[model samples]
Target: MPNVVLLLAALAFAGCDVFESSEPVAFTRIALPARPVLVNGTTVVRGDYQLSAFTRSVNDSLISVPTIDFDRQTVLGVFYGGSFHAGCRGNVETIEGIRLAGDALIVEVGPLPDLGPCRAIVYPSDMVVVNARATSVRFVGAVPQ
Candidate 1:
């Protein structure tokens, strides 16, 4: 009986470490819009913001979602979940001082304050056929419709 009690106590203590060391899953992908999108009434070139990828990190509770952007070789933007203080619930708000290469389109999230560059690739599953003009570009499986 005493051994069983000790084992239970040890198991309970170990569970706390499970949440402590686990990092949130970060999703990275390149998203292309169906059609050309206009930013501030300006028609953004097709390839200008096309090859961009983003990484978003979510907490264990799935409340706040912070995103970071990597455009070919530059960090475009960083947005935090300020409005959704309880959990991950708000859209990415761009961080100032960081300029996206060419035009602003896709963004991502990171743990540090530095953006890393990476090559962009369009996946087969990400291709979508649409007739209307696209307004924004996002990472695959990152943005919610």
Candidate 2:
């Protein structure tokens, strides 16, 4: 009788642990400025943009490896041309990473090993801004002097 009661109590506790609620997680969205910034000679375009930042979550299960998934989020930045579109290969001194998100494209500068080759987007009205950190860049529409 005592063992049965203990087992029931343990099950109840486990159930509570499984059913417990957690606070909602929030992620900050950063908008690319209207002005383009140049970092390390690489030009980044600024506009309403979205990119994938990789992350993983695990579930409690046995006899199976943890599954990996991707979460898609939107980031505002200028659209930069892609290497495939530009017909270029290898490291291009200015561009670093190019990714397609929805209808917009993202061109990232600095160290992004995961992202493939990048190409600068050239628009007749596009303006460029240089980054002081030398690690980031952005492209945007014309900025008022």
Best by TM-score: 1
Each model's TM-score? 0.21, 0.19
Give the whole-model CA lDDT for all candidates, comma-separated.
0.28, 0.29
Candidate 1 at 37: error in angstroms?
Answer: 6.3
Candidate 1 ranges with C-alpha deviation above 4 Å: 21-145
Q: How close is candidate 1 to the true structure, as a TM-score?
A: 0.21
CA shift of 101, model 2, Å? 26
Q: Residue 140 in model 2: shift from native, Å?
A: 35
lDDT of each residue in 12-111, candidate 2, tens digit only = 9989855544222222223233232322222232222211111111111221212211223322222232322222222222223344433334344333
Residue-by-residue lDDT tens digits, candidate 1, 60-118: 22322223222223222222222212222122222212212223333332222212233
User: Which sections of candidate 2 miss by over 4 Å?
Assistant: 27-145
True-structure RMSD for candidate 1: 18.2
Q: For model 1, where is the 10-residue window of minimal lDDT?
A: 122-131
User: What's the count of clashing pairs in each model shown?
Assistant: 10, 17
lDDT of 2 at 95: 29
